[model samples]
Target: MESPSKGYLDVGHLELGGTIQSHSSKFIPSDKAEFNRNMLSRNKIISVCLLLLVITLSGCSRINSAQGWSGILVDDDRLILASMDGHIMVLDKNTGKHMWEPDLMRVKEKDEKKRAAYGLPAVSNGILFVGVYSGKIQAVEVDTGRTVETEV
Candidate 1:
């Protein structure tokens, strides 16, 4: 009768009941390089797409004619407000008709600057007072689109 220890091989306290099987340990270096290249290419494409999305969104924000952080004011039948393009647009509250649009920058012949109006317009006695980002305050008459005063 043969001893049980003679039939099994002991490897680090683990006994192998059967013969050890061997697998190919060969590695293709080109496959690894190709995988790395594919990963880098994918990362670059994602980066370019993100950059393009950001640029497109930024451009869209600027392209809009009525962009601003100011709040809207409804007085009587009109909706008075200031826009990011430094323009005052008064529209009909019910019909949404354009009553007037007074572009202060255009009146100053500085339309190229495209200043923003961050403050809400104050309406009192049928007059609208708006403060622009360029440190200018404009007083406009609600009855007409005419600017009453522009203080720089």
Candidate 2:
């Protein structure tokens, strides 16, 4: 976010330039007057563009789960969440619902330990990034919901 303290936000008056009449082009400096008009117009355009971008991007993907108070993250437009039991979930953002989740413990030994963490899930470039309690970092596909890479 930009520095909010550096900008002027007036609450004292309704009209711009503090109630100047439309036809009163009295003693305003040309450069300062042009700058004020240009800045106002530019800020309005930029604000609208930013609003549109946020709405469009936030519609991309989302994910939520019934895990034990875990966390989630966005992988590009895809959503990734994790459970305390090492289960990974992926979702489509438009609905805040899961698209896929895998039983990470299914193929492991029955005595395998579970991965748990207090940190929020992290994702990047279509890869759902996560860390296990055993010190392993894992990255999975945001689309197919498969483990694409892993490291310590």
Question: Lowest-lDDT window of 10 residues in candidate 1?
Answer: 6-15
lDDT of 1 by residue, 47-137 (tens): 9999999987887564554455577888889887777666677888999878764323232326536456666778888777777666767
Relative to the unseen true structure, what is the C-alpha lDDT of residue 95 in candidate 1, on a scale of 0 to 100?
A: 92
The parts of candidate 2 lying over 4 Å away from their true place are 1-67, 75-77, 101-111
Worst 10 residues of 2 by lDDT: 103-112
* lDDT against the true structure, each candidate: 0.66, 0.59
Candidate 2: Cα lDDT at 133: 60
By lDDT, the best candidate is 1
Candidate 1 residue pairs in clash (backbone atoms < 3 Å)? none
Segments of candidate 1 deviating more than 4 angstroms = 1-69, 101-111, 150-152
| Clashing residue pair totals per candidate (backbone < 3 A) | 0, 3
lDDT of 1 at 23: 31
Task: Write one digit per residue (lDDT tens) for candidate 2, span 33-123.
Answer: 8999999999999999999999877765344433463676765665666666667766677886667654242212133454654367676
Which candidate's TM-score is highest? 1
